[model samples]
Target: MLLRAALAALRRVEPVIVLEQLGSTFFDTALQMVVRDRCANATDPGRSREDSQQKAMTDFFMTYNLILRLTPILPSLLLARLSDRGWRRAPVVSSLCGYLLSRLGLLLVVVFSLPLQLMLGAAALFGLSGGYSAFWSGVMTLVALRSSAGDRAKAMMRVELLYGLAGLVGSLVSGHLFQLYTASLGHGTILLIVGTLLNLLCLILAIVLLQVKHVSSEEPEEKSLLPPTSSNATAVEASVSTNLVNIVLLFVAAFLYDFAVGGAIGMLGPFTLKAPLSWSPTQVGYGNAAGCMIFLTSYIGVILFRRCISDEAMILIGMLSFASGIYLMAFATTTYIFYIARILNLFALIPLPTIRSLLSQQVQPSSCGTALTLLQLTLKFAGLAYIPAFTKLYQNTLDWFPGFIFLLSSIFTVLGMIPISILGWRSAGGKCHVRTQGGKQPRCHLEEVPAGTSQTGTET
Candidate 1:
């Protein structure tokens, strides 16, 4: 019941969250166009009034963009704490309330002044939507860890499938809406209406989730099957020498990988729109939808191969696939080639959840949230450091030396594959003993079951 309610609420709010994100992307594009027009006409002899208005709008959008980046980090920190405290449901409720109130406030502000409304509304939507990504990522990670090994891959696949479907539908619809109402209704106004409706639906879902009952700990059969070390005493010490080594290696690898990939993606859409391969907004949206489709299909394949192959092998395959995709993208000469490269790139990402799941199994459950959060923080920090530099390089050099920036990005991705290769080699050589399933005792190596032993199946 609790799960049903929670899912219902998620479904309700998800569309609004998606719409807001789409709107933010659209606003960024629109703001860029306005800025360009303003700069072009700044020298006009009789356009002083228009110049002033354009400058004001440009400043507003720039400020809004800055807030969009910063505001999400604060809420993410709060959500991290809530996750650590096991207040997952409470955070969901809070997010819903916050989104609704922000929307209502924006609506009133817009009523008083259209300009202020656009600025504030864009900022609020961006922050709310951006924060939702991390919030949902954390929630899904927890869910994956809590589930049985048999169900873990399937659950992750399901989440990916839903995310893809949302992206596909949302992007296509938003694009059509914008094209249809470009003259009649501003894109911002239409986005606001869509967002409001989605938030209301999400609120209803959140209310429903409050009534679902969690399983009782006192149930005799359940108690017998539960893992040992559920108490605070079992919290893994962060200072333990071996644990510290593993953690450091994991963190470094995550940082490098995310830094490269994040920087590349940060510039991807913008570069596509303004470069040798200038793609229209609809084309970009379609590309994104295609990537999601590829990701969803590859995710299913990952689940299917989970039992047939070792985790190390899977990771290696994913990395290789990713590296190949990056190289292909670096040399893409046409839209079709770009689409193919993106599909391959999506396939390469299939191992992310699997890798995270592996990391979770290495640590005690009590510290799972902290471990995951640390990894997330490291990746985000790396991305922040690298994105601007890469974006500048891509923007300045993409036209004259097409593919140069992409080539550099591809090199970074290849470098990231090194640590994963090392880890995979170590794992396949039987050195790492991280159990992929929940259990009372930490095993030193993979289990050796009788050839004929029957394995129990759990629901996905």
Candidate 2:
């Protein structure tokens, strides 16, 4: 049922997200052109009026993109804040209502005037993205808190699978839909209309889903995994413990790795569209579909190998796979090679969920949302930081520059490998134990612990 709700919500909102991104990009490009034209015409005193008009449009476009990017992060921050509190149904309902209002306002704007349309569209995008991020993050955090330690990994895996599937399907369908609509209606306006409607539907569904008992309230005497907040001193100590050197090192490695991957992933669609090598939108969609298919297969592979391979080992392999795959993608001169790279990239991403699960196990349950949010924030910031660089590099050197970017990215991947080996060694040596002792060694458990560490006599 959770999966079903997730899929339904994703299906309704994914198109809006994709269209908003594309529309923003398009407007930004158009705004640049208008600025250039205005500058060229500004030499004539009679053209001053036109120059001012063009300047306004350019300003609006630039502001729109800036706002759109910033908007999504606010919701993430909100979710992080809320996660520290006990989970409740009220926030979910409030967020859903917010989403609906935003969508409705957007629809009205589209029906009225162009200026209103642009303003409302930007606001709607911000609200929707923020709301969705907060809602999903909270939902996942709640689920993690409710599930048993043994089941948490599986649950997270399922969430990842669903998220990946949604992204895959969403990207393909949205690309095709935009392509089809751009011919008949203006791409921006049509996308806004459709996106608004879909979001409204999502709001309705979310409200209905909130009525479920598990979602409505905390279970009786539920032992929350979150750490106790008994005293300011204890809270300070706990926070300090979370900032350990090893944990900081892990965050750095994770940040760089995610930064590189985020840059490559975000640029892929635009690269496909603008590459000297030709590709239709449909073709690009198919390539994405292929990647998703490979990801699904790799996800299953990870589950099967869980008993045989340690989590650290899996992460090392995933990093290598991601580096190699991206480099291949950057240098691929042929469609088949591009497709191969895409598949490998998808396969490389399979270990992410497992790594996240590993990280959760390392922290107190209450701190999971904060820890994960910090990691996510790093990735978000990295994406923003690298996107302009990627765009500038593309403009200057085109295809050649992507290869260099990938090579730089590969270095980060290699750096990540070092930590995995260190962490894996430490885990194998029983250094970071997390479980209570039993009469015998736990079999088929891939948790992090020190070498020669036997849980048979230890307390959790």
Candidate 3:
């Protein structure tokens, strides 16, 4: 019994999620500090130090994030294909390797006082090995495959809860940890070392012990969610076609929302450092911890919301929450006001996981991983446009209105809701039936009509 319990514990992915988020939190703060310091040191005497520092920081991230997003496309696609083919851990294991390498790369830079430009290469390496695009999709696929379709959203929320708590702990402590350094170890070196070691430990855990075998959520029950429909090939084809359309719509919604959130958020790291809120490292940590708090809140939102509303409704609620909060963020020059804006954004994380859950329900278990990865890659492509565009917008409006980008994020988020609305409308009107015997996708289905029958089963 003791050994069985231990094995069961090892099968849980919570430890992996915790360690990964913890290390990432440490790395995020360390990177921000070092990058800002380097840019500050490099400012030309003729230029405004504040303006130059901000511009260079945004410019650096603009390029670095582009590389991070770009390099992941092909590698992520490849990993997803492998994952669909039964190499279930391919993406997670490969992405974790990238994480370890990238952490070590940053560690080397901080410890040796190496040129900051080297991080660009590190980002590329990270992306080439699948990055978050693959890693997160892989994680979602694991949960999606294991959980029943009905429970996918809650399952995802639990994972996010674990992820959030880890990030909270890491963010709360990372600032102080970054400030800790002996004479031998420079500022941030100790932090980087801890992050790297933790990442290494995660990689080791992923390689040696992480379970790959999972029960596919293809039980007889899910296929029977809808009443018995015709077994006609034409009906099946029609259902598939409708599903394809709905899938495309879901993809658009996800893309728009991510573009809004991603673009604005890419600027936030730099935004906090300017003017009235010139936050110290501790404040930065606190701010990050505040952001992490939403994961917990979003989990609760999903749990309670799921009991009362449909998945599409939950997504819209989350979007509205973010849109309102981010719109308010445009006016926040004070830390207190910023926290309030963040609090308003509590339900923001709900959309994507629910979106993932909805997408999983639209397809068969075998293709679930690929569908999830494709959604992530779609968001990645969105990042390409948003990251640079928002950076430039932030740079151009820095003197006049730095919060302009946040307002734009609000607009995109509102626009994103349209697709989901359309999806919800169509779903309500459409007649859907799941195949009970032959396992097939649920996204597209139609009832068969007799030669003289109307869709209502009446004579024409």
Each prediction's TM-score versus the true structure:
0.70, 0.67, 0.91
Cα displacement (angstroms), candidate 3, residue 5, comes to: 2.0
lDDT for predicted candidate 2 compared with the true structure? 0.53
Please write out the lDDT profile of model 3 over residues 194-240, one tens digit for every residue: 99999999888888878865665434432412323546777567666
Name the candidate, 2 or 3, with the larger lDDT value. 3
To one decimal, what is the Cα RMSD in angstroms of model 2 from the true structure? 8.4
Give Cα-based local distance difference scores for all models. 0.53, 0.53, 0.86
Please list the Cα RMSD from the true structure of every candidate, rounded to 1 decimal place.
Answer: 7.8, 8.4, 6.1
Q: Give the TM-score of candidate 1.
A: 0.70
| Tens digits of per-residue lDDT for model 1, 189-240 | 4544565666666556655643322222221222112223344333324223
For lDDT, the strongest prediction is 3
Candidate 1 residue-wise lDDT at 67: 56
